[model samples]
Target: MSYQSDINPRHSTWRKVRHTLSIVSHEPANLLGALLLMLFSWIILAPVMSVLLNAVLVQSGDEGRTGATEGTFTAWYLLRTLTSRMSELLLWTPLLNTLAVALSTVAMALIVGVALAWLINRTDIAGRKWFATLLIVPFMLPSWTFALAWSTIFKNHAIGGQPGWLEAMGIQTPNWMAYGYFPIVTIMVLHYAPLVILIVGNALKRMDSQMEECARVLGASRGIIAFKIIIPLVRPALLSSALLIFADCIGEFALPYILGLPVHFDTLSTGLYRAISTRQSGVAAVIATVIMLMGMLTLMLDMKMLREAKRFVTLGGKGVMERRRTLGRWRTAAAALPLLFVLLGVVIPLLTLFLSTVMILPGRFTAENFTFDYWIGHNLDTVALHNGILLTPEFWHTVWNTLVIVGSASIACGVLGLLVGYAVMRCHFRWVAAFLRQLTFLPYLVPGIAFATAFLSLFAVARGPVPALYGTPLILILALIAEKMPYASRSGIAAMTQLGKEAEEAARIAGAGWFARIRRIVIPIQAAPLATGILLPFISGIKGVSLFVILATPATDVMTTWSLRLIDYNYQQAANAVVLMIALISWAGTVIIQKITGTGLADGLEK
Candidate 1:
């Protein structure tokens, strides 16, 4: 009897272990969710924590200044950044400038974007399809493209290098026009307005026309109907777009660097860059922390707006009726508005950029002055450029690095996103699934520059078995993957949600293993979204500058960084050439992706 009691206790414990293992083994998604949770915690959560820690700790460079041991906790850095004499120059002024630029940009972008969205989606405007495609072109290119173009045309001899087109033409451009707040806001609005169009347009498209017709039946004027009904109906999208634009403007690096730097018009991003360059790691950490907090706040507000949007649902059990408003006598005028924006935003900037690349002198339009030296020449001694960008081995090498690194990261992001989606949708534990989803999205709450700063702080030195990634291409790939996780994961989740489980269930019943089911069923079914997950990141990475600026070494330079280097060298023509190439590549990539998937950039903005 004693022997049987001891054996029974042991046997019960073994059975419980076996049962738990069986459950884990049968549910591969749960296992995957757990694994992904750990991986993301290490990559995403750890870096953010590192940023916070570095902010509070006495960094190596600041130890002597703070009179503290290195790695010890100190609030001296925070105090200096916020309360010291230089705090106004270092933090407060930049914060105010960032806020000013962000608010102005959002307001202007809303006006332009909402107007275009209404014209294209709600009105019977001419070339709606063509206008829609054309409007989104500005977004595909780097945000700095317009800034460079602005400089190419309006630059003066304020800081002195090559004169701008206006100066070359004996038309002295004012510093205010060429740089500082006005140009910064104008260029940012041009760049970010397309985002507004996409988001608001999606909402407009999904809304029922019955509401508008009812408003008209009540004898409401067009203006009254628009202000009271249309605007309110799309308020959620407007709020979300405003917050997103504000966040983007807050973190913008290259635009401010190009246009604002000469005039000493500092914003938080530029200030952070200056801090890091000066090796004030603690100050930089503090600034990065602030930027991250702002981003998180924006994300929270965006989520709140999204949740509140449920209360304003336009869809019902009945089929949606979408009717475009007839422009009547104003059709041509309405069409002309979008065309005008395209000219200012796309056509003119591109033309100005192309012209600058071809001409030796900024404003000169002479045959002898125009040359292809920037594109193909071997000897360029005047500007100190050894060879044309197309002929330079460094340029080619950088292009290759961009393709390999960004491409690999994008592929990884897509695959991991799909896996994340699969695990989130299919995991056994609801809390685990929710955790994995939120963790993957945490990266989106961080700005690119701040996120790069975090990665630099965390990965500059080896942690345990991981080697130092400070100057390596591996760090760039990892950062790109993490930075882009939100887009990829969202794509993955949306695709998977639309897909029913019947096929996978049938495969499981037929004795198909998890890997086999994913390979034979899930992947094939969600190929388009999977492709979208890859291509979106690839395009964004190709045009990206802020993320790579701090992290990329000379050997690991991408096209965007290469262009920035050229600018530093005062190789204006060569820089414009590189920027043009980047824009072309991004545009072509977008076109190809849309062609293959039959999905436009605006399609993703739909709720």
Candidate 2:
């Protein structure tokens, strides 16, 4: 009996030691993966939940609050917002207005984008090389660039400031023509259509002409063949592009912030910005949630449609290239459209910014008034201004801060994106894949303002064991990493998906460690996309203003924020110069990245 008892005790103790060892010796990849996923989930969910929490918890306006601020379990805020003041809070007025603008943009893109895509892809159009590259250039530039140019071109004397270029030429541009829905929609359409053309054109290039030929042999008219065969085939891609544009427009802040502000044309994006900037944190959160819900709904719908139809999925077979469609005499008109599009969106805006930089006065373009104070001034003795960008120490500091923030953020996002992609794609568990995919993609669904606002709460205080990230460049990097991981993760996943587990398995059989295999084999193969993954965030981070608008301090200020400050003080000329510098830098980086790495914002396609 004593022997039996002793054996039982030993067995139990052995089991305990085994459990302890298991806990201590878990794989680093798995442990780190769990920790990272948990961190991301908390960062994304906490702020959203905070909004939900505040929505329910009563705040006593006994402290004297106004608007949505006065409330307590009364449902007054909800009822009031949904009912009589619904027009203001639901912002149906702006909502409807934004919808019209969005739909108009889509319509314009469909017409213009399809024409350009066909001309470039199928026709022997003139300057095919330059047109393809220059045509979509507007897509790379910030959306507000066009809006700023529009203001420069036609001030309409409604804003009560300096007259614009047309006015300088003795033209009286009307208010409706210059400011409201007409111009806002027009600018957005031209700015956004390049995306459609690129996305749709890529699809077009891969389309099988055999189907069209099959229809033609069956006595189908050319128009019928084109409409029935070509249009239907490309419809799926067009819809996807349109949906993305819609989501983008829903989150748009700067365009409306710039163009709509002058005319009092308030979209939800602008409205939400006002709410936050004015300290209506709760309302802004609510607006943000609403916008996010809209985006989520669209995403869900798109996914559902994609699953149901499955038509958009590209077949892996090689795309059979066909004869180029001879444009006949109409080729001139076809080629001219792309240049016209570029002129409106890219060339004109660039010209405006260039001209504005040279001119001393706002609208007047002359030689004597022009000075180099903004670019290369010695003392900036031009009164009340800092010295030239080249001469100023502050500008250099800001530029350095921008590089650090963007560079660090890009690397962080690239590594995280790669890790997430590896785990989600290669891991065996279904939940891990689903959870990682959903969470990484969640930020895309959240509006940038909401996402930024949520992080504001997150890093606001140092938790008991957690360090505060506020006021540090690390905070900006973290925000950018979170905001950008969506795309980086997507590109990584796509690249890794194309490359199967054969190489990884071979390394494992040779007893190679995980890190070595990833470094030598995986990265080298996926170098272009991985590099692109870094380049994109770097460019985007350097250019981003909306996400940093709330987070920027003098210590953490980057180029975009610095330019924004200049704009706030109405230093339009200096702001223009800064923007030009930013564009040039991004353009140069894009060229370097593509020339060396051989990938672009699109995949590896040269077009």
Best by lDDT: 1
lDDT of 2 by residue, 1-607 (tens): 3544455887899998887557534333444456668877776666666655544444444225333444344343344344555537445666777788888888887888888888888778877777877877888887777776787788767776456788877888998778878888888888788888787787787777676667778889999987877777778768877877787778777778766778788887777777667765555556666777887777776666556556554344666645467888887777778888888988889899878777767666567878777788666544446677667676778899999988998988887777777777765555767787888888887777667777775676685787988788877887888889888888788877888888877887898878888898888988877877888888877777778876778888888778766766666777778888888887877787777676555451133
Clashes of 1: 0
Task: Give TM per candidate.
Answer: 0.95, 0.88
**Candidate 1: segments with Cα more than 4 A from true spot:** 1-18, 315-319, 500-502, 505-511, 602-607
lDDT (C-alpha) at residue 286 in model 2? 61
Error of 1 at 589 (Å): 1.3
What is the per-residue lDDT of model 1 for residues 1-607, given as tens digits with 9 covering 90 to 100? Answer: 3554456787899998899788779889889999999988988999999999999999986777899999999999899999999999999999999999999999999999999998888888888878888888888778899999999999998987899988988999888999999999999999899999999998888788898899899999989988888888899999999998988887899998999989999999999999999998899999999999999999889999999988877856568887888888888878888898899899999998898988977788989999988899877876457888899998999999999999999999999999999999988789998988999999888988899999999999988999999899999999999999999999998888888889988999999998899999999999999999999899999999888999999989999999999888788889999999999999988987999799777563332
Which 10-residue window of candidate 1 scores lowest in summed lDDT?
598-607
lDDT of 2 at 207: 75
